[model samples]
Target: MTALAATSTPSQDLPSLIERAASMLSGAKTAAEVLEAREVAGLAYDVAKRAARLQRAKSAHDDLVAAAHRAQAHALEIEARAKRRLADEYDAAQARGEVAGHGGGRNFKVANGNVETTTADLGLRRDQIHEARQLRDAEAVDPGIVRRTLDERLEHGEEPSRAALRKMVVDAAMRGMRPQRRASRRNPLYVAPTPEQAAWRHVTGVFRAFAEWASDENLALARKGMREAGDTPFHDLDARAIAQGSAAFTTIKEWFDAR
Candidate 1:
């Protein structure tokens, strides 16, 4: 036997060993060879069971991580919304002189033992929002580090299954969570077409005009010509195809006009 076959653990080479044992059983003529094959096959079964248990453990860990992340994000969102609502309420109270200082301007007293003035309550809410945001941003898993670790594991002859490899790649490509920015309170405005959009519109408009001017027979011919050029109505043609189609339609129109 080679060094690899000698050093390989049953878990790592279970499938190959199983196949070899099956082959040996098929070729066995003596009782001793047949008994050896049976022992190897039984060992392969144990290795397979161990591999499955490891896979299940890995899957459970991943599911727990995913659930933790989702819960963190949901808590952050709720905290942010609560903070905004509290700020709005504080501003409204101040505007109506319900939360003003006892003597004059902005000073206010704490109300109940557990609660305070609107300003102080708002401040507390803001602090809570900041803490929650930080907690949400703190990720336990570093995808880049995970990818490197995966590579090192594979290099050491610890082979991860295909599903595990896919998960590792996906995790490495995922971006870290951060606090979402509040949407700007700006009025919507109409925007003009971009230069690329304008050019494409011009090309398509030329084709449309030709289609409108062409006779029925010529219009049918134009459709056939575009189809022959590999253009499909269900999909938008590329710029080159658009230019070619426009030129073809224009020629067809001119031919019908001359007639």
Candidate 2:
């Protein structure tokens, strides 16, 4: 049995081989037939075990891909926050006039033993701040290239440098910013009046008709009917008022119609 197992052809497609083996097992009758069925069943079992291992490996690879994307997104968020903080600090320093070294007009002792007053170059920090702001805006508008680059670096087990990330952001900006798609506008639900309340419109039309054609005594009777039905004399015709007035309207209309 060991010799036969060792000599059996390696299965290229495990699932197909397993199905064939199952068919063999289902039709076994004699001892020789049963032995052949058992051998096929054993092969199927081995193939199933191999398939499980392959599935696990595929799952692990998928998980790694997901982790890479998450890491990229988190890193970009951190970078954006740091740039914002730096810009804020730079603004505060400028406001306090503490960035004097950035502006011109300072005297320094030269290596040649001569005291020289030279204009200080104060715009370096400001330029850096401007570049940071531009990169941040570009990232906000279209982060696809930056995200892809960072994810690739993470997949390769390399830490992406700040310079590389900034370059990617700039490259994306050069490629033209992609405007974000507007979210689909949904009309808000129109809450219909309750059935009882909605019936009040018919009731009010009847009241208006009675005011024009009916006698004062009949109109007084209608008002009394409305009060009895829980409607205020000067109801605002809101949901509750409509609900209360529905019964009064029905009673007045029926009396007038009968007359």
Candidate 3:
């Protein structure tokens, strides 16, 4: 009991000393124990702080990984948009090439599903108009033929310009037949007024003055009266007789009034 045990080496006794200290600190209650527990608690607090720092670092790493995934997704979307744009440009170029391959004359199918050449259609219409105009111009005959047809129509009560009439004329000409002279007929009149009688109304009072003067009577007034009578074809001889001074002015006036 009196002999003391030899102290163990510091390195060899470290684990045992730490174990005892931990137990003491765990059970500490008094002032000295509380002070020792405080130191132990401070060390434990430092350990907890280090553990919290590690946890926060791991959380930050997880957050960075999620952000990286989102960034990659955004990059993929950008790439997809660029690819679509490129495809659109390529399609547009291909369409342009196809359009260019066709010459200036592009083919179009009509509603009837038939293909027709535009130029040929226009030419056909032009030809139709030309033919119609030629037909009209060709049918326009000489005026001399029209005039003869009109005269024949009036004298014979014939419907002229008939093909039968044309053939008859042609046949007669071929046979050297002489066309007979058509007679001009006169209408009968019940009473034929003398020229001096017809012109009596046309005689001027100025001519009466000339007749009263005898030789001094106005020749000008007599000539004017004759002109007035001659203006009308319905009376003739009486006007000339009055102008020549063959009929008495009073007789001419009476004949004119009677008419």
Question: Best-fitting candidate, measured by lDDT?
Answer: 2
**18-71 per-residue lDDT for model 1 (tens digits):** 445545555654323333454454455445445445656677564333322222
lDDT of 1: 0.42
lDDT of 2 by residue, 106-210 (tens): 332222335332323212344656665565456445433455666576557554445667777667667866333343245345454564654565455455754
Q: Could you give the candidate ranking by lDDT, starting with the highest?
A: 2, 1, 3
Error of 2 at 142 (Å): 7.4
By lDDT, is 2 or 3 better? 2
lDDT of 3 by residue, 39-107 (tens): 332233233334335545677664333322222222222222222232232234335452122222322
Best by TM-score: 2
**Model 1: number of backbone collisions:** 0
Candidate 1: how large is its RMSD? 26.8
Better of 1 and 2 by lDDT: 2
- Candidate 3 least-lDDT 10 residues: 1-10
lDDT of 2 at 195: 46
- Is candidate 1 or 3 superior in TM-score? 1
Query: After superposing candidate 1, which stretches have Cα over 4 Å from the reference?
Result: 1-60, 100-118, 121-259
Off by over 4 Å in 2: 1-60, 101-131, 137-164, 172-259
The TM-score that candidate 1 achieves is: 0.22
